[model samples]
Target: MAITSANQLELLQTAEAVAREKMIDPDLVVQAMEESLARAAKSRYGAEMDIRVSIDRKTGRATFTRVRTVVEDDMVENHLAELTVAQARDYLENPEVGAEIIDEVPPVEMGRIAAQSAKQVILQKVREAERDRQYEEFKDRAGTIINGVVKREEYGNVIVDVGRGEGILRRNEKIGRESYRPNDRIRCYIKDVRREVRGPQIFLSRTDPQFMAELFKMEVPEIYDGIIDIKAVARDPGSRAKIAVISYDGSIDPVGACVGMRGSRVQAVVNELQGEKIDIIPWNDDAPTFLVNALQPAEVSKVVLDEEAERIEVVVPDEQLSLAIGRRGQNVRLASQLTGLDIDILTEAEESERRQKEFAARTSLFMEALDLDEFFAQLLVSEGFTNLEEVAYVEVDELLVIDGVDEDTAGELQARARDYLEAANKKALEEARELGVEDSLVAFDGLTPQMVLALAKDGVKTLEDFATCADWELAGGWTTENGERKKDDGVLEPFDVSLEEAQNLVMTARIMLGWVDPTELEAEAEEEAAEESSEDATEETEA
Candidate 1:
C-alpha cells in the first residue's frame, strides 16, 4: 500500500469514528494508532532504530520519523539512538547536547500480523477507558440500590449487566433463597466499587442491611424527606428482618408510615426482598424500652441492662419465652443486632432460679471471707452487698440500713471486712516476696498485693520486668500466639484486673521507675482523677 493525502484523511476519519464508538478520547485513539504504526515500522526498519510516528489531528496525515539525541562520543551507547555533536551539526545549524535530531522515515506496509497487533492495542486502550468510565460512574452509587439484568451466572455468582458496566453479585451476597437466570431483571444494593488491575469491580448485594434500608427509603417517602428515619435494620436475609424507625415530626407515626396504608409500603419492600417477613418497630431512647419494642409479639416482664458490658437481660413470662426468643433464637439474635446490644433472654422462672443461685453464692462468699454467720451474711446480701470490696468500702450508714443492725453492728462489720482484706493482702505480699518479687515492684503505688503476687508467679520479679510488660499481659485482651491473635481473653488469672486498670497500673510502675516522663504521668493522673470525680458526681446525682 502507498500513502496518499486522501488515504491519510480517511485514516483520521476512521480514528474519529472508532473513538466515538468506543467512548474513548479521540486523542487516545490517535496515540494508539501512532504507537501501532511505529511498532510495525520497527519490524521493517531496524528494531534498534529510534522510530516515532505522529498523526495530524487536522488532516489525519501520518508522519513517520526517527529521533536521535546529540551526545558526546563517550556517552553515545547506540549509534542509531544517539549522534555526537560533530555528526549532529551536519543535520542542523546548531546542535545542543540534549537536543533531539529528527529525520523523516517512509511508512512501512502493514502485514496481517502487524495489523492484528495494532487492533489488540486499540482494544486494550478502549477497555481501560471503559473501566475508568465505569469506576467514575458507579463509585458514588455505593450504599444505594441499582437495577440491572442478570447477564450470566458462574458457579452461583451472578454477573449483572448494569448500564455501561458489569457488577458482580457474589454467591454470599445473594439472598439465601433467591436465584437468577440470564436476562432476569433484578434490583441490588451497590455494596462497593473497587478499582482493580483488570478493571473497576462493582459489588452488588441483596442481603446487606443497608440494602433493606435503601429499599425502604425508596418505598417510604417520609424516610427520604427526613420526616421519618430508619434508625436501624437487622436482617436474616431470606427468612426475616427487623427495622427500627423514629419520626422527627411529632405528628408523623414512623412505624405507621413505614407500614403504609394497611402495610402497603412495608409489603412493597417485602415483595422486593422475595417475601422475607418484616417487622417494623418504633425506636425508643431508653435501652430497656427499646429492647421491649425490639422483642415484639412477645410480652417482656422486665429488662436488666448492663451498660458497661453492652448487654441486656430480658425476663419474659414462661409462656412468652418461646415467642420472645423466636425459632432457634432468631428473634433475640435479630433484636441484638438491631439494638447493638448482646441480649440474653430468659423466662421469669429461669431468672428467679438464677437469682437464688447468685444469692446463695454471695452469701457463701461473705460467710467464708468475712467469717460472718449465715444470718449476718443474709442481712449483708439483702442490703445489696455483692462483693467483699463493697463491704469494705461502703459507708457505715449504708450498712446500718440493714434491719436489726445498729451503729455498733455496722462498725463491727466494717472492721471485720477491713481486717479480712488486710490479712489477705499481707499473706499475698509475703507469698510474692517468697517467690522473689523485687521490693520495688511489691511497693509500686498502684499495684495491689494480689497483682504483685500474680506478677511474681508470671516471672515478672523485677521492676524492669513489670515496666516492660504490656497492659494486655497484666489485664485482659485477645491472646496472640504464633504471630496470630486468637480470641482468648488475657484475664491474668488470680489478679482480676480489667484492661483499663491494668493499663493504669502499668503506667504507674513505668512512671515510678523513671521510664516515662513525670509531666506526662501527672497529666494522665489529673485526667483520670477528673474522670473519677465526674463519675462520683454523676452517681451522687443519680442517688
Candidate 2:
C-alpha cells in the first residue's frame, strides 16, 4: 500500500483527535507512537534497526525515518546488511567506521497486529496516568471519616461508593445485628486508602476506636475545639463503654460538657453506637478516689490501700456490696481496670471488724478495753498506752493536753501514776510473750520491773497471756514460784489498777509490737475489773 501525503495527514489528524478525547497530552501521544514504532521496527528488522516518528501540527502529517550503522563487514544481518566502506563512501563524502547512515523506510502501513499493539500501549499508559491521579487524590483522605452510599452487597460485605472511588465495609467492621440495604447512606471511618490494580481501594470501618472518638468530636464541641480531652476509653462494642475525660482549663467540667444538657449530647453518641451504654467518668489522679467514683451507685465507706500488692479493699454497706461488686463483679472489674488497681469489696460487718482491729492497733490494747467506764482508763486506751511503761513515758503535761482531761486531774493521776504504769506495762509484756506475739518486747525500750510484777500478779503469766484469765485470778493476783503472792508485799496494792487495765495494757503492748489482735481489749478489761472489785467488796463486807 503506497501512502500518499493526504493519507498520512489524515492518520495524524485521527491520532490527534483520539489523544484529545482521552485527555492525553499531544506530546505524550507522539512520544508513545515513537516508542511503539521503534519497538515494532526492532522486532521486524533487528536491534540494529532505529526509527523515529515525526508529527507536523499544521498539516497533521506523520512520517517515519530509519537509521543504520555503517559497518565494515556484512557480519551483522540487520542495518542494510552492513554496507562495505567502499559502498558507504559512494553515498557520503566522509564516513566513519562506527557512524550510522539515515534512511526513510517508506511508511509501511501498520498491519492489524501492529495497530492493535499500538492501541494497547496507548490505553495502558492512559490507564496508569489515571490511576496515579486517583491514588494521589485519595491518599490524603486516610484516617478521615467519609460519607458514602452503599452501592452493593457482596457476600455479606457492603461496598460503598465514595465519590472519587469505592470503599469496602467489611462484615466484621459493620455493626453486628444491624443490616444495610443497597443505596443506604452511611458514614464510615476511612481506615486506609491505597492504590490497587483496579483503582484506589479504600478500607472503611465502623467499629474502629477512631469511630468512637469521631462521634465524640461530632457531638461535643469542646472536644473538637480541644478544650476538653478524652483521657482513656474502653469499649465493648454494641454493649457498653467507659470514657475518662479531663479539661485543660481548670474551670471546665469535661464530663458535664460531654454529657450535655439532660444528656442530650452523650445520648446522641449512644444512639450512633447502637444503644451502647457510655460511662463518662471524671479522670482523677488519686487512684482510690477515682476507683470509688468508677463503681457508680455504690457508696464506699473506706478504702484500704495495699500499694505493694497493687490491691485495694473497698468497704461498703452490706446493702451496697452487691451494687459495688456489680453484676458478676463487672462494676468492680471495670473500676479496677480503669484505675489500674485490684479491688476487693467488703461488707459493713467486715469493715466494722477491720475498724476495730485498726483501733486496737492504734491504742495498743485489746478491743475489750473499749468497754471500760473509767475516764483515765479510757483515756489511756484512746492513746494506745495499754501498759504502765507507756503511761510512765507520757508527760503529765502531755496527759493534761489530752481531750477532756484537766491539769489538776493529770497532776493527781501522775502522783500515783508511776506504780500503776509499771504494773500495767509488766502485765502487757507477760501477756504478749504468752500470746506468742512476734517481736514482742524485742523493741520495747521503757519497761519497768513494777509493770512486770503487776502484770504477773494479774495472772497475766504465760497461761493468762495466751488465753483470757478469769476475773478472780486476775483480781486475786497470781501466786509466785513458792506459792506466795506474786507481789512483793503479801497485801495487794491499794491503788486502783483494775483487771481491765491489766487486759488493756497486755493487748496494747501486743499491737504496738505488731502482735496478734482481737477486738476492743479496753472494754473487756473494764468489765472484768468491775466484776472483780464487786466480788472483793462483797468478801470484805462478809468478813
Candidate 3:
C-alpha cells in the first residue's frame, strides 16, 4: 500500500478502533503506527540511514524524513546517519557539533512482507499497552473482593472475566468442594495483582482469611460503617473458621452484630464460603482472655501465657478437652492463628500432674544444690525459691518469712547457698578457660560464669565473637519452617538470658572494642524519642 490522499484518514480510524477495542489510549496506538511506518521506511531507505515517520493526529497524513546529526570529525562513525561539523554547510548556515539536519523523503511503498512485519509491530505495541492498562486498573484493587463471570477452567484453575481484564483463581485458592462452570457468577478476593512477561495477572482467592472478613463487611452494616472492626480472621477453608470483632460503640455487641437477627449476617458469609462454619468471638486486648473466647463452647479452667515466647497453655475440664481441641486439632489450631500464639491445651488432671512434676523437680534442685533435706527443700520451693541464686542472694528477712526459720537458721542457710554458688562458679570458670574463653569475655558485665562456659562451648570464646553474636542466638528463639514452628537452641539460653539482656551484653562488648560509636547511638535514640513525641502530640491533637 502507498501513502496517498485517499487513505490519509485511515490511520487515525485504525488507531481509534484498536484503542477502543483494547480499552487503551488512542495516542499509544497512533505512536505504535508511527514506529511501524518508520521501521518499514528504514527497510526501503538505506538501513544505515536514520529514517523517521510521524503521523498527523488531525489529518492522519504520514510524513517521512531522514535525520543526520552533526558531529566532530573523529566521532563520525556512521557517514549515513552523522555529518562532520565542517561538512554540514550545504544544509545549515552554521552546523554545530550536536545539531540535527532533517530533509523530507517520500514514504516507502510497503510490499506484502513489509506490510505483514508492520502489522506485527503494531500488534506487539498494542498488546503491551493493553497489559499496562490492565495492570494500572487492577493493582489498587488487591485485598478487595470482586464479582466476575467464569470464562473457563484450565488445568483445574478457573479463569474469570473480571469486567475489563481476566483474573485467575488457582485450584488451591478455591474452596475445596466448590466448582464453577462457564458463565457462572462468582465472588472472590483479589489476593494479588502481578505484572508478568506475558501479561498482568490478577490472582483471585476464596480461601484467604481476608475473604471472610470482606464478606462480613459487605453483609453487616455495623462492620461496613466502622462501628465494629474485624480484628482477626482464621479460616480452615470449606471447613470452619474463627473471626474476632470489636465494637467501638459500647451499646452494640460485636458478636451479636456480626451474627445479625436470627444469624442472618454471618449466615450470608457462611453460605458464600461453601457452608463453612464460623465462630464470631468478641475481641479482647488481653491475649489469654481473647484466646479463651476464640476457643468457644469449651470452658477454660486456667490460662497460662508466656508473653515473650508468644505461647499459651489452656487447662480445661477433662470432658471439654476433646471439644477444645476439636476434630483433628482444628479448634485449637484456628485459635492459635486467631491469637497469633502457639497454644497447648491440657485437661485439668493433666495440668495438675504437670504442676506436681514441676514442684518435685524444683524441690530436688533445692535439696541437692543447698544441701538441705527434702522437708526443708519443699518449704523453700513452696515459698517460690526455684534456684540456688535466689536463695543465695535473697535477704535474710525473706528466708525468715519461711516456716520454722529463725535468724540463726536463715544465716546458716545463706552461708551454705553462697558456698555452693561460689564452688559452682569456680568450676564453670575453670571449664570455660579450658575451652579457650578469654578473660575479656569473662570480665564482661551481665554474663555469669555459667553463661561464659556456655558461650565457650558454643565456640563464642573471644570478646569479638560475643560482640558479633545475634541477640536471638543468645536468647533461644523459635523459627517457622514449612508452617511449623521450630525452636533454635541459644548458647546462653540455659543461663536464662533474655533477648534484651543478650543485646545489652553484646553492645557493651562492642563499645569496649571501639567497633561502635556511643555518640551515634545516643543521637539515634534522641531522634527516635523526638519522632515519638511528635507523633504523640499529633494523636492528642486529633483526639
Q: Best candidate per lDDT, number?
A: 3
- Global CA lDDT computed for model 2: 0.68
Q: TM-scores, in order shown?
A: 0.87, 0.50, 0.94
Worst 10 residues of 1 by lDDT: 484-493
Ranked by lDDT from best down, the candidates are 3, 1, 2
Looking at model 1, residue 163 earns an lDDT score of: 87
Give a tens-digit lDDT track for model 2, residues 204-308.
998776787788988899998999987766665677677778898899899899999999999998888899888888888887887777877689988888663
RMSD of each: 5.5, 23.6, 2.1
lDDT string for model 3 (497-535, tens) is 888988898888899999999999999999999999999
TM-score for candidate 1, please give it. Answer: 0.87
Off by over 4 Å in 2: 1-108, 194-200, 285-543
* Error of model 2, residue 83, in angstroms: 15
lDDT of 2 at 317: 89
How far out, in Å, is residue 391 in model 1? 3.4
Order the candidate numbers by TM-score, best to worst.
3, 1, 2
- For candidate 1, lDDT tens digit of each residue in 286-370? 9999999999989999999977456789999999989999998899989999998878888999999999999999999999988
